[model samples]
Target: MGAAVAAQAKQGGAEVLWCPEGRSTETRKRAIAAGFSEVSDIAEMARRCDVIMAICPPANAESVAGLVSAEGFRGIYVDANAVSPATMASIKAFAFRDADLLVDGSVVGSPPSTSKTTRLYLSGSGEAVAVVAGLFSGTAVDARILNGGIGKASALKLSYSSYQKASRVLAAVAHGLARDWGVQDELIDIAGGRSTSYLAEPTYIPKVAARAWRWAPEMREAAAAVGELGFPDELAEATAAVMERWAEAKDQSLGISEALELLRTDGPQTAPGPSAE
Candidate 1:
C-alpha cells in the first residue's frame, strides 16, 4: 500500500522517501523496487518528508503515531489503519501535539491497479484533507474527503469492514457446518441460485484461511467500533475468534481441506446453557 501510494504521488512529481533501517528484507526489497530515496530512520524521514502516511495493522497504529510524534514531525500525518474511532481519538493524545495536522484516513477496495481502483477516505481539517486528496489526484487511488472531523474515516472503515469481514467469516463457518453434514456441495448449490450470494463462491474458505491472521485483529477492532455505538458486539467478537482458529494457515499455500482442518469444534457453545438461579 505504501508502494502504491508513493508510486502514484511520484507521477505528479512528488519525491518519495523511505527509511530502510530495521525494516524486514521483504519490506526493503519492495522499497528498493519502488525506488524510494532512502532515509536513515524515522527521525530522518520525519525531518525530510512533508507528509508521512501510516499504513499498518490496527494494533500498531497508536504506537506508530507516537514514533512520528516523538520526532516532532510537523507535517501531515495520515493514519490509514483499520481501527476503532475510539482508538483513533486516543492517538490524538500524542499525534497532534507537534504535528501540523493529523488526518484520519481509511482505504476501501484492493490496491490501486490497472484493472481495479481503490478509494481512500479521508477526514479531518478541510485544508489538510484536501492536500492529502490532491496527492493522489488523477491516480488510481480515489481520495474522497468526508465532512466530519478526525475519527470519522476510521469509524466508516470499521463500520463497512465489520459487515464485509464478519459476514464472509460467518459464511465460511456455514460452509464448514454443511461439510460436517455431508451437504456442503448442496449448500453451495442452494446459494448459487441467489444473485447476492457471495458465500456461494467456492474459494471463499481458502481465501479466509490465508488472510485470517490479518483479518482477526481488524475484526476485533470492528467489535470495538460496534460496542462504542451501543450495538451487540458478539458477531464481530465471534468472527475474530473464528478467524484466529485459522491463524496457523495464514498466507500458506494449502488446499481447502488443509485450511479447514485447523478449525476445531471446541469453541464456545453456540447457545447458552440455563443459568443457575
Candidate 2:
C-alpha cells in the first residue's frame, strides 16, 4: 500500500522519500520500484518532505506519529492507518503536538493501482485536508475531504471495516458449523441458491487467512470503536480471535476445504485481545 501511494505521488510530480531503516528486503525492493528515494534517517525524511504520510499497521500508527514528532517535524502529518477514533485522538493529542497540521486520513478499498477505484478520505482543518488531497491530484488515487474535525475519517473507516470484516467471520463460522454437522453440501446449496454468491464456497477462508495477521489488529480496533459507540463489541472481539487462529495458516497454501478443516480442528486458543490504547 505504501508503495502504491508513493508510485501515485511520484507520477503526480512529487518527490517521494522513504526511510527504510528496518524494513524487509521486499519492502526496500518495492519502495525502489515505486521510485522512492531512501533516506538514511527518519529525521532527514521528515525534514525534507512537506507532508509525512504514515501508512502502516493499525498497531503502529501512534508510534509512527510519535517518531515524526520526536524529529521536531512541523509539516502536515497524515495518519493513514486503520485505527479507532479514540486512537486517532490520542495520536493527535500527543504524537502530533509539533505538527503544523494534522490530517486525519483513512484509506478505503484496495491500494490505488488504477484511477478512481480506491478512495483516500481526509478530515481535519479544511485547508490542511485540501492540501493533502491536492497531492494526489491527477493521480490514480481518489482523495476526498470529509466534513468534520479530526477522527471523522478514522471513525468512518473503523465502522465500515467492522461490518465488512465481521461479516466474513460470520460466513466462516457458518460454514465451519455446517461442515461439523455433516450438512456442508446442503448449506452450500442453500447459500448458492440465494443472493449471496461469495458465501457459497469457503474460498474466502484462505484469502482471509493469508492476511489474518494484519486483520487481527484491525478487528480489535473495530471492536474498540464499536464499544465507544455504546454497542457490544464481542462480535468484533471474537472475530479478532478467529483471525489470529487463521494467521498460522497464512503460509500453509491451504485450499477452501483444507482451510475449513484447519479451522474446525485447530480453532483459535484463548488469547489476550490486542491493546487499543
Candidate 3:
C-alpha cells in the first residue's frame, strides 16, 4: 500500500520521501531503489513531511501515531489503516498529542495502483478533509470525503469487511459441505449460477484464504460491535466462527494453503481436465 501510495504521488508530480520503521523491509528497499529520500527516523519524517499517512496494520497504527506525537511532529496525520472505531478513537487521542490535525481515513477496496480499484474514505474536520482530498486530486484514486468524525471512517470499513467476511465464510463452509456429501462440484456449479459467490469466488476467496489468520480477529471485533449496536449479527458471528476455525487447524493453521486445501471440493482425480476420448 505504501508503495502504491508513493507511486500515485510520484505519478502526480510529487517528490516522494519515505521514513519506514526498522532498517530493512520491502517498502524501505523499494523506496530507496525508487530514488525516494529515506529519512533516518519517524521524527525526521514527521518534521519534514506536510502529511504523515499511517499505512501500517490496525494493530500497530496507534503506536506509530504515538511515536509521531512523541516526536512533536506537526502536520496532517491520516490514518489509512483498517481498525475498529474504538481503536481509532484511542489512536485519535494519541494523535492529538502534538496538536496535529488528525484525519480519519479508510481505504475501501484496494490501494491506488494500475491494477487496483478502491476508494479513499476520509472523515474528520472539514478543512482536513479538504486538505486530504486536495492531495489526491488529479490522481487516479477515487477519494470520497465522508461527513463524520474520527470513528466514522473506520465504521464504514468495519461494515464493509463484515459483509466480505460473511461471504467468504459461506463459500468455504458450503464448499466443505458439498465435498462431504459427495456432491461438492455439482453444488458449487449450481450455487455459483444463482449467487454472488460465483463472482466473489474468483475475486476474493483466494486473497482472503491466504491472509485469513490476520483477519479473524478483526471479523470477531466486527461481530461484537454489531451485537453491541443491537443489530442482528448472526452473519458476522458465523463468519467469525468459521474464520476462527480456519485459523486453528493443523500446524499450518491460519494459513491460506491450509484453508484452500480444506475448502477444496475437487480431488486430484476430479479436478477440471480435458475430456476423456
Q: Which candidate model has the greater lDDT, 2 or 3?
A: 2
Pick the winner on TM-score between candidates 2 and 3: 2
How does each model score on TM-score? 0.70, 0.68, 0.67
Candidate 1 has a TM-score of: 0.70
Model 1 lDDT-worst window of ten: 268-277
Off by over 4 Å in 2: 98-100, 193-277
> Lowest summed lDDT over 10 consecutive residues: which window, candidate 3?
268-277
lDDT of 2 by residue, 1-277 (tens): 8788868888888889988888999999898888788899998988898898999999999889999989998889999999987898899789775323898899898888864467899988777888889989988888988886777889889878887887776666556555656888998898777675444556777887778889899989867765665556787788788778776776567776656655654453443322221
lDDT digits (tens) for residues 41-87 of candidate 3: 88788789887787777788878888888888678888888898778
Q: What is the descending TM-score order? A: 1, 2, 3
- Candidate 1: stretches off by over 4 Å: 98-100, 197-277
Across 1-277, the per-residue lDDT of candidate 1 in tens digits comes to 7677677777656788888766799988877887778888999999998888888878989999999988998999999999887787788765774323888899988877777788999988888888989998988888998876777888889978987887776676556556666889999999888786444564678888899999999989867765665555677788799899987787987776666667866632343322211
Relative to the unseen true structure, what is the C-alpha lDDT of residue 247 in candidate 2, on a scale of 0 to 100?
61
RMSD of each: 15.0, 14.5, 16.7
Clashes of each: 0, 0, 0
